[model samples]
Target: MSVLDQDLKTPIRLRSLTWLRAPWLFWGGLLILTWAVSHYAFDIYRALDARWIIRFPATWQPDFESRITAFMDWLLHDAQLFGILFRDVTRAISAVIEAPYDLVVDVLVTGLQQGIGQQAVQILPPLSWVAVIFTVTAVGHYTKSWSMAVLMGLCFTYLAVFGQWESAMLTLASVLIAVPIAAGGGLLLGVLAFRVRWVDRAMRPILDLMQTVPVFAYLVPILFMFGFGPVSALVATIIYAMPPMIRVTIVALRGVPEELAELGRMVGCTRRQQMWKVLVPSAKPMLMVGVNQVIMLTLNMVIIASMIGAGGLGYDVLTALRRLDIGGGVEAGLAIVVLAIALDRLSQAYAGRTVTQKAAQSQGGFAMRHRWSLSIIAVILVTGLIGAAASWLQTYPDALVINTGQIWENAIGYINVNYFDTLDAAKTFLLTWFLLPVRQFFVGIPWPWGLMAMTLIGLRVGGWKLSLLVFVLTGLIVLSGLWDKAMMTVYLCGASVVIASAIGIPLGLLAASNPVSNRIVGAFIDTLQTLPSFVYLIPVVMLFRVGDFSAMIAIVAYALAPAVRYAAHGIRSIDPQIIEAGIVSGCTRGQLMRRIKLPMILPELLLGLNQTIMLALSMLVITALVGTRDLGQEVYIALTRANTGQGIVAGLSVAFIAIIADRLLEAAAKRMRKQMGMA
Candidate 1:
């Protein structure tokens, strides 16, 4: 195995000894070499570009763009038989889903999405904003969360001050409607999947597909069928948000011990009774986690929903971005973040409340005991009296409104004067010294060899089925002629994930090791996590200018929060007894972490990596706006043009990359679990 060995006498030995130790490195180099030869030495681009990537003429496989568009057109226009059946089915679904749409609009505003729902169903027109504010205050008091109440008030006040009350109300109403539906549907489906073996088998892949596909993909068909409005956005939001709920549900329910379910049966409980009284309650904590996730995801879609004319803060941000008004977009984006933070805190606090809270309500003071009832009655009378006294009391006065766009612009000017030069130099160094080389390595890979190398990776990680998937998807990208862009995305996302993991894992370890540190860092991570992806763009654009490097930084910034969060959770969740064992064995803190903590926490860390991948890909799409020439750019362009075919293909490529990473990680985790006797 040394230099003395004949097999070790070559460059292969050097690669085997160093770079190839990481699979990513090994395949990357081989693919780059293949492409270098193909492009520079042989000039294959002529033939490839001639067929316009239609049929790899070299192989005979069809291009994805042309074929997918043809398929979509056939399904929609040519397949009258199938089209009629689908049309009828969607018509029924559209009719059924509209009920909730009407209800949501009615509860939020009077004339919204007018004519969609019955006039008799509209309810909130009679209620003043003051009434709604007071109700939120009452709930806040009940939850013992003055901070949450203040956040909510600030959020609403900001919306009012900005004269965005109507838009803000629409956004909240959509979320209010979407969360329950997403959470409820997810819970039901999750329960059924958990209870039925076949259902679980069927659901796993479908959920994977649903979650991995970009949220924008949902708009294409739904917008076509339902036209535009709240219902379309609501449906897309539900679909986009539900996967996490379903996943958490399955994981939580299964986490409940078999002995507990057996105890329910031992008490002579029937199947339904046992499921209701024992299983569901046992899984409440995880179900609540799912609910928290559902809320965040639904909010995440606020801007994407705006793309289809679903108005609100997202629309405001989109409008600002469209006008190239960075200050205005940042303002709107801030409002969305505040809205997200308020919603996230409210949902978390309510979800985390214990039986003791209810017990206190029964046994404690009048404020606790009466909670919402007395507060509601009083607030109603006070608001009614105020409305009677002056009409201006119903909503914040226009005369008192503040314009913060100028403030944001002034702040940008200050930053540019003070820090822009330093930031530009650093960005230049990062691009010239680091990212360009890595990006070139990835983007230079020849299609055929890249496909084979990825297939090999699939074979090593999973099996033939995975290899086939890798082969097919990679081939699709090459054929679609979006190969360079897709690889650029791969390079950026991969680099960002690696950097994020490096930073996050150590930070997580620090937090995990100390209770106080955990709380402090957890708060910071929570704040970062709640900021909308849109908000991540503004500062980086200010610092680095519009480019791939800036996009990478933004992707990492948005992605890093989840990495640290899950890593800390994984490390902290390690069994205390195992740590005690390590201590009894005379291990130091460092040794205990290496020998005991890491091994036990590896599975959770892999799950974190999976999450990190998804977050990075999601951000990449947003970064495309900042001038990253990746699949996100294609998707972004597709958005502007409403190019369904190009968007779908590009989105699927991003999805396939994420799914492949997920599958590999999952495969590795399964192997680790088996080795550790966890499976």
Candidate 2:
């Protein structure tokens, strides 16, 4: 049948318009309309009033502060109980396992300490900062090319000149340690999960939850288990950073050619041997990508972990934020950005080089000769030693150190003189007029109303099963007495998602129209993604102050990437033939884009919206740093107080929200695709 004939037989209907006409819309709209009517039209705002009342136990006086005190007392009692249990368990486990491992750990620690101590004794003085920069440049050149080398040299130069050497080194040390540990754990987990169906089934939801839950929720549990130190920070970073590696590893392993698996079997290879020689080797690229992700996540978390006393560049950033020091935060944030870029590039180079070297080896050329590679390594070593020896005459200084006090004073002074008044004014308006009113509406709804609304929406979109799941998840929040906090979170997330879609979609459309713009915007998105969210929050706090506005801005910045990415993907994926036909049929550029291109990309755009929502939810915990009173805030408070139960509950609430949104959007996307005959 001809295309025009097919169209006549089967008419195209836009889902958005159909959705507007659906009965569910009327039901939802009527409920909202009625609520609006009662509240605004009739001046009956009783249902919109805050219902929560602060109450104190009999042991405390009946006052607001007394209630807070009583709650803290209860919290302390619970913490004490947890501490005792934890200590007893640890001691018991230590008695069982430490006898063997204590000696091993001691021996290793002592040996390493002695070796490092002896090496320190004989070490040459620190090289000139110039020489170090040169060395980095040379290393970069060796890895990639002169442009990268020069860029790396300049980056290191900035660090040294800015006197952030020690802080940067400390941050680097943590990441260097954390990445390997996370990647190793991820590799093992990924392999196990892929090899065992039961493991995969058990782990998939966990991975999803881990990825979805805001990072703040894990902080308290980690702090409790490891205690407050670099070790705790390290553990938290690893946990937060490891999931993507595990996911990618599983995906890559599964994607390996079936013929390769069969070939390994035909060679009589054991399962372990097949995994090691065939499966793993073939999946190296994906595994490397995972490694890259782990590295990025670790670097990103370094600053965040610092807030809980991780101590590093992150500490500096956090301090700067607390003091509302913009320049200092920017300086520290820049260092982090440079570090992220360097590490990212190095990993990419390593991965790309691995592929190239493997191809060279397969070709069996002079370039593949071990002797040449070994000689190059020998020369590098000799050169390093010579430089080390020559540096002995010089006095070594400590790594770069920033005068944070000066930066703080200057930045705070500048903001106080110029920006603080404006920020205060804006904060008053937002709080008094917008945020407070919106928050009141969300928290005012009886728990049942919110539950019914979300459940009914889920049911209509996904089905009865998803509806039940949604009720169970959200219902748990209401029952746990976290309904208000969850609602506040929903409000913030909802606002951020709306703003992100508004900005991201338009940018994506513009970028999709041209190649140069696409590359430019694509690079910006990449930078935004890799740049730690915390770093973005620093400048935001400086500009907007520590309020919902700042938090929303940061959330929108990070969350918008997926929207742009998916929107671009959707527009690009539209068939060229259809676009040409639109043009040939006398449609203007705007008409072609509006009618044909936009509709064609609706499914992909919907998918992007799904991703944008997910990303926004993920930022809930991180955005707490900007001083939100949402579930993220509760999670943060739980961490500081070691309230694991509250933290977990809040985290799960966020996760549930994501899942509900995810399922509904996915179903809608699927339906749209099917309706478009593109399923």
RMSD of each: 5.8, 7.7
lDDT of 2 by residue, 343-435 (tens): 888777666665564465456556554543554455445544665555421212444344555665576668768878787797788668866
lDDT of 1 at 369: 76
Q: Whole-model lDDT, candidate 1?
A: 0.77
How many clashes would you count in candidate 2?
A: 4
lDDT of 1 by residue, 121-167 (tens): 43224345777677776676676567767766776767777766766
Stretches of model 2 off by over 4 angstroms after superposition: 1-143, 354-441
The most accurate candidate by TM-score is: 1
Which 10 successive residues of model 2 have the least lDDT summed? 104-113
Clashing pairs in 1: none
Per-residue error for 106 in candidate 2, Å, reads 17
